[model samples]
Target chain A: MRGDTPFIAGDWGTSNLRLWLCGADGTVLDRADGPGVAAVPGRAEAAFLDATAAWRAADGPLPALFCGMVGSTIGWVEAAYHPCPANVGSLASGLTRFTALGATMAIIPGLSTRNPQGAPDVMRGEETQILGALASHPDLGIGRRLLCLPGTHAKWVLLRDGTVVMFQTGFSGELFALLRGHSVLGRGTDGLLPQIGPAFIQGVQRSLTSAPLPHLLFEARSRQLLEGMSAQDALSFLSGLVIGADVVGGIAMAADGLDGPVTLVASPILTDAYAAALAATGRDTVALDGGELALAGLLSVRAAILS
Target chain B: MRGDTPFIAGDWGTSNLRLWLCGADGTVLDRADGPGVAAVPGRAEAAFLDATAAWRAADGPLPALFCGMVGSTIGWVEAAYHPCPANVGSLASGLTRFTALGATMAIIPGLSTRNPQGAPDVMRGEETQILGALASHPDLGIGRRLLCLPGTHAKWVLLRDGTVVMFQTGFSGELFALLRGHSVLGRGTDGLLPQIGPAFIQGVQRSLTSAPLPHLLFEARSRQLLEGMSAQDALSFLSGLVIGADVVGGIAMAADGLDGPVTLVASPILTDAYAAALAATGRDTVALDGGELALAGLLSVRAAILS
Candidate 1:
């Protein structure tokens, strides 16, 4: 039963590379990883080959489906962005295919749309994750939906009739990291939020009241000095403030244009923060595990290619 | 006049220390500078001694007056903060006096006030700058006034009847530096805005329309990639967005409570940016040189101490 060679599913981005060897039944049979597109030097052909050598030796030359920053202009092979509104079928059709080292290969294209200000916004791997979410829950495709993928660059997406119509990018997560590590206001914070605490809720309340975030961020430090806030509490407060601002700003940008139950496709860590922020603003979220969606997306693309 | 060295006026901060030898007529005779408190490894006494050695050789034992981070907890000697509403008289009375290196020395205390959110807000050297502004232009002491000093830590101060009632700090400048150097949004930006251009105005307009700043900042990169914005334009655009956010947010925080023309006390470089941003928001500003105010503030404090 295990004699048959399988396909490879790769998620490569700026920071790290994650891979899975999937059987014909769509179950993961083996795993592999390597440096991300940013960390790999030269052509990246060697690194890819090296990362998968053992699996290749066991399974023979197998076809691979890759997503994320590997398709970016700065990545291995630049697969140009496909304009939305696009669905799973359209995304698969746009995949840039190539062959090297006796293996079939395909790289998923990123998505681009005009933001609220009518400027271009983009996302790479998350598009596949969205596709995977659609695959897992057909009911999610029935109506208009708002989807959020929270991470270093949080993406707030609008899906109309199963196709991603538009999206916006917020630098909230990146900002939190930068400020916590390198800023005076974030000096005392340790960059961890174990549980949603009082400080976090207070931060959400403050963000709702405070306009223009830069003016209020310093309170992270000031509160510690004046009110004896702990480092962990300060981090939580900062997180809530950023998330609250994102939610408020995202809604304002949406401006009643999109409607549906909000589907949050993120890791548990991010989901907790976003869920709390959304709840504070009187909105509820349906959580979707990002890893499951990612795998499902890879399988859908693989099936499309084989067909 | 050249024969007499009346006293040493120093603006010592976390990063840099500037000193001036002043004559009895309040004219600067000579100047020197050195690394600030943070740059000095162990004790700051040595750096202070070295910086003023030339002045000491000429003047014997001149009294010194310092204002800035030199009075902070991490500075030369911990000069405790004076609570507002405080004017020059109250500020002078809070001075921490000491005798070292056969020189009579005193450091002006920083000012602290609760912001609109009831969080602690503080400023050190800028307090002396405010005092200097009052000394140079007596008219500034009248009515309720707002003062903005834009820098690494931009300060927005409210003065009522010649006393500083309250203030807020925005880390706009530092954020700009960090983003430009460290964050992805600031990539390719040279961090120089030779003059405000169309790109800059566009940034201000975008910021005004886009409420939550963290969401909108990504436009700096999106515009460049989508519309082919040049690095110089991108940098200018980023600067405008930051200034705009600070101005808009600061006004909202003020909440129609503090009423007066904003006294922008800064160097020519910062004044240009803040002035343009304020003008864009339909607010006029009265400009004052930061150096002039720092000297005036020191002289005022010295006079207070002597009297």
Candidate 2:
């Protein structure tokens, strides 16, 4: 066992588990990654330990703070959710205690939702990213900001005064992967996204409205196969639908209204995909870096653990 | 040579290739199924010969009548298209002849699109089914009937006055498979489709006209995952969306504007699924036996060859 730092932070998602060794200042001095909780299933604790065992020292204890899905019910430990209008504490205060490699380890809390009448919709991982984004960009922390973290389960969260007001999720990416890679449309796409053009925009507009569009999709590929629409062009048309559907979903959530510019907080690829989709809607908004938010969240949880 | 038979009939599709030995009496003395045209690709002729080479010893020299994608540009040979309102003679009259098995083999023509700019969507194999159906159900030959052939590529053919008026295709079956097998919803479903109580009808209604459905289908699994919607129930709900969407599509194609009874021609499983979907729309339909259509189609083609 080796001691490179006194603290460790981890980002756990469905497919990946990443741990970072940091000093008191929150610099990622060393990092480790493995299959996240979802991928390993019921072994969140073991997975976490395995990733950081090398960083453990024979000479005593180090404080480790965790964020992301590790705090989920299926996570390293359950981090009960704090409802909307939350604070930095709303994101970081609810702590789940644990010990690994004889080091003091704790997992941060996640957020939950109570729809009009159902059981609470809890989110353990994304809440951490929200906290990180807010801590990094204090300006976005003020007033209402629309935070879009696009992924397998793209989260559309609304925030006010650093608190999560409300949020929803979309399966856009998953749908895209299924449609283009595994579906009959897969033949029309050939693993390539169509170039964004009029077809893409038209597809977006079609997805956004309540128009009877079930039949139009038949034409998406038929046009290419029967009408000679290029394969690339056909896929671009399809991308218009997937991305367009995403924009429509996010816009619907924000129907309550937006007081500030839409602050899209996501990885570059997803953020750009959303931008393209939203562009089809003819709406403009500002984009913030997703990595920065993740960092800021680590810092926030790190401080909360020290406190 | 065995006996005198004027023609040989073949049905070649994506996964199955079937051949029939028909006498002048239109009696199927023998029948067989092998890997379809798509599987054999460029070697379709050899594959066809290999499947029926036994006939070389007899049946004299006869023309081979074939249908389906076997006549696609990518198939063994390109069959010229007979536009909508095509007849049995219309299909046979425009046939493209190619020599094979030391016999005069004439591959039946395919249907083509009316789209001026794009490729005319056509069907080689299905045309024979239509011919078969018309011959067997001459009663159905009288008026406008919707010929529903549900499969990977579901075809909706409108027949008027015993002639195919206009037709459209939907990838509904394919979409259903991909969505339920490859998407996250697939995870919630576990590859089995159950009956969707009210959520399915609700989903169908919402999808047909709702602008920006909330929860992005996380709700489908959410009800199950968080609120106890059963996997079977969720699968049913998912099935409803796809099938319901397909119905909405067919309705959209009808100039009548979502106001007609859909005659769903499919197998028992697909028929039930369609019935479940049509529940929400409250639209009634006649579900015909799939086997009857195939048999009738084969017999009709056999009779036509002798005539």
Candidate 3:
């Protein structure tokens, strides 16, 4: 665990696994990907070993750190959730450690909290990204802020003084995919990406109203039938509707209202969509790369364990 | 057409076709079913002929009247939609008449209206039911009543003096199916009907809040993961969530608040679910049999055309 000892870090989720080989100085030397925890089932150890064979060969017996669903019950080994209000130190101490394939490995525990509605909510990979963002930008750890991690299951997180408080999960991404792929609303928009234009903005605006989502969603189909909206625009409109609803719900879930710029930790595509939707609601946002934050979060955990 | 001449009346929709063999006095002698518009693309005429061959052989060539999607562009013939402020008279006048297999046929046009959101909404089979309900219970036509026809695409119709003024279509039923069959919320519930008990009532209460649906939906999963909610309860909760949202939206979409008993036209199962959800909202509902109403509606259309 010395400062100059090279190691491997990973963010393994339900769909995919990403691994980064870091030098002793915490610089990323190389990166690789393998089947996610879900893909390997009982063979997660084999998949992990094969994905890092080259790295282990070059840097013998390097310790490894992992985050996300790779620590869930279905993962290599269960890393029981770290209850909120959690931070880097708590997560580092709670890591599920074990030896497999002649290498020491630690999987970061996910975070669990009760949302404002008094329902349980959980996040695995996003906690690392949030911690990484805070560590990389120390100023963000000083005051209350809202951070949104948009993905298959978007997270709306509240941060105070570098510690994670409560957050809500929105199924907008998954719902959108299901509707677009399996519902009648997606009749003609096959293999087409959502276009963020007037239709999308209109959908966002519509979502802000008092109309229930199930009612508003019908407009995606009705508009095409009556208004002659193109298939691409209908898809875009559908996208806006779901994302807009998520953003609206997220803002309401935030405590004391969002008085500051919300930090968005996501890939560029999601970032753009979220930023646009947030802007439509008269809110400001600061964007950060999710991968970079995950790496930084891992490094912070490494530093914590070492200290 | 004479008053004592036997005729065939049908409610042909997207999924299935139900036909009633009516005596000259409008009494139903027998009933048969056939494939819907979606099932027999270009072979609608052939399917219709095959389904009614036995009846035709016994009664000779009888005139037929049909309603619902049988009039859509995809049906046997495009019975163009009758615009808003439609009544029995309007629907009868708008019927698309034709001759098929040496028998005269007339298809009742669907109703089209722009919702309060200024978006076009259309209904095919429900319009017939609404008109039939009004014809059957004349008292319901005297005032401003909200009639909810719950089905695959639930419709909330605003009736004024027996005329269909404006209505909104809620995709709740379709959405519920999609989520239950394909989404993560439906994960472990295989072929189980939603039990409308505490979980469903709780979901309905939850939907009445300001929270966005995509966020509230995740509770179905989180509760199972953390609170030990059974798969059946999760499915029931999901159903309540969608249906409750639809009711809330329908109330909002109503030109005036629901001040009277909302008339529910649906099958027994849907009636029980909708009635329970509506009751939870402090709204009184009067349930009617959908089949009886559809038949009554078709008979009313015949009377309108004859007059």
Candidate 4:
């Protein structure tokens, strides 16, 4: 066995698994992608073995650290939730341990908090990403800030001194997809959410108003039928409206409000739309790459474990 | 051909067509159901012909009055929209006429209005039902009232002196189905919306608060996973939330601020949920059957034509 001690970092989610084989210096030496926990069900043991077979073969079973839904109830190991006011340290402090298929592994626990309404809210993977973002950009560690992670379930984190004080989840991205796939608003256009267009800009502007979302959503089709808006534009407009609502709604729910420019942890595709939406609302944003932050978050967890 | 001048009343919407062969006095002699305009496209004429062939043979192609999306641009004939501040008289006066395939037919025009933001809004079938509601219960013509028509696209009409002064459309029902069929909120539940349960009642209560809808929606799943909310109850809760949002949101948009108890024109399945939501919000409701009103609206159109 080539025993130089290269470690494995994984961001396993509901849909897919991403593994980064990193050298001692945290430089990626190799990578592997495989079916996510959801995709493999009871076969997660075999799936993991198959996915990282090469890495395990090259090095003699490196100790792996994982984050995301991999630690969820439906995931590899049911990692208990660490209640909030949780920070990166708290998450790293509570790792669920397991030994399977000749490899030792650990999963970072998710964060749990009661919303203002006292309803329990939980996030599995996003917490790890947020921590990673915090670690990657040390500047974000200062002051009270709003951190937005846009996705199927977009999270708006209220951070104070590098700890997640409270957070809100919006079903904006998933609802946008649901509307596009199943509603009349979805009619008349291809579903790809292109860059921010005029229709999308209109949606963002409308979101700043007091109009009800259920009513405002109908505009996607009404604008098309009455104004002769193209279907493609309608798709972008739908996206903008959903995102805009999230931003506007999220801001109102923030206990401290946004004290400074919001930090956006998003992929490239989402960067422009969210930036434009934020700009429209007269707010500034700092964009950070989500993939990079996720990797960094996992690496941070590894450090916490090794130390 | 036997001819007693019996009239045909048709409610043609996007997905299905429901028709009644009524006696001279507006009593239902027979009924027929077929695919809606969206289902048959260019074949609408032939489909209508096939749907009512037996009745046509007996009644010798009596005068037929149609309402709903059959009058939309995408329907049988592009019946023009009668602008709001419109009444039964205006709608009846704006019938688009056509003769095709051995039948004299007229489609009652839909109504159009600009939202407070000047965005163009239009409704076809619901307008007819509102008129029919007025015709069926003459008491409803007095003073000011709020009329709610719950369906795929629920409509809230502001009625003053028997005229529809303005209206708003909510995608609540459509959104409910979309979420149920295609969203994570849809998970952990059978899609059937049961009667008002504790989960549903909880949703209605939640809607009355200032919680953002996009955020509140995630509770459908969160409640399930965290609080042991059942799938069936989650479905009902989802329904309650959507309906609650529409009612609460619709009230805020009402220019006259609901002069009296709202009149909910809904099918049986939607009646309890909407009524409960309205009640929870400290409002009373007068329930009316949508189907009967649709038939009455068609009869009113026939009277408007013959008179």
Best by lDDT: 3
A1-307: candidate 4 lDDT, tens digit per residue: 1124687888999998999999876789988999989898878778888998887777767767888888877788889878889887788788888887666788888888886655778888888898888888887788788888999988888888888987888888888878887788887556465458777888888877766688788888877777788788888888888888888867765545656788888897787788889889878888888977789888877666566
To one decimal, what is the Cα RMSD in angstroms of model 3 from the true structure? 1.7
* Per-model root-mean-square deviation over C-alphas: 3.2, 4.4, 1.7, 2.4
lDDT of 2 by residue, A1-307 (tens): 1234557777776667777777766766787778967787888767766666677643245677777777765676666666666667645556777676566677766666753223235566777788877777788777767877887777778887888877777666676677677755658465576566777766676577543333445556666656677777767777777667667767765667676767677777667767777766666767777765665687786676456
> In candidate 1, which residue ranges exceed 4 Å CA deviation?
A1-5, A188-195, A253-260, A304-307, B1-5, B190-195, B253-260
Per model, state how many residue pairs clash: 0, 15, 0, 1
Across B1-307, the per-residue lDDT of candidate 1 in tens digits comes to: 1223487889998888999888876688998999988898567788988888887887788878899888876788889889888988898788898887777788999988997556788888999999999888888888878889999989988887788988888879888877777898777655465358787777777778756887788888877767788888888888888888888766655566555678899998888788888888787788988976888898887777656
True contacts kept of each: 0.74, 0.42, 0.85, 0.65
**lDDT by residue (tens digit), candidate 3, B138-256:** 98888788899998899998888788889999999999999999998999899899988999998999999878899899999988888899999999999999999999988775546
lDDT of each prediction vs. the true structure? 0.81, 0.66, 0.89, 0.81
DockQ (model 2, Cα): 0.31
Worst 10 residues of 2 chain A by lDDT: A114-123
Which parts of model 3 are misplaced by more than 4 Å?
Answer: A1-4, A254-259, B1-4, B253-259
RMSD of 4: 2.4
Candidate 2 C-alpha error for residue A229, in Å: 3.4
Which docking category, incorrect, acceptable, medium or high, applies to candidate 2?
acceptable
| Error in Å for residue B280 of model 1 | 1.4
Q: In CAPRI terms, where does candidate 3 land?
A: high
Q: Which structure is stronger by TM-score: 1 or 3?
A: 3
Q: State, as a TM-score between 0 and 1, how close model 3 is to the true structure.
A: 0.97
Model 3 chain B worst lDDT window (10 residues): B251-260
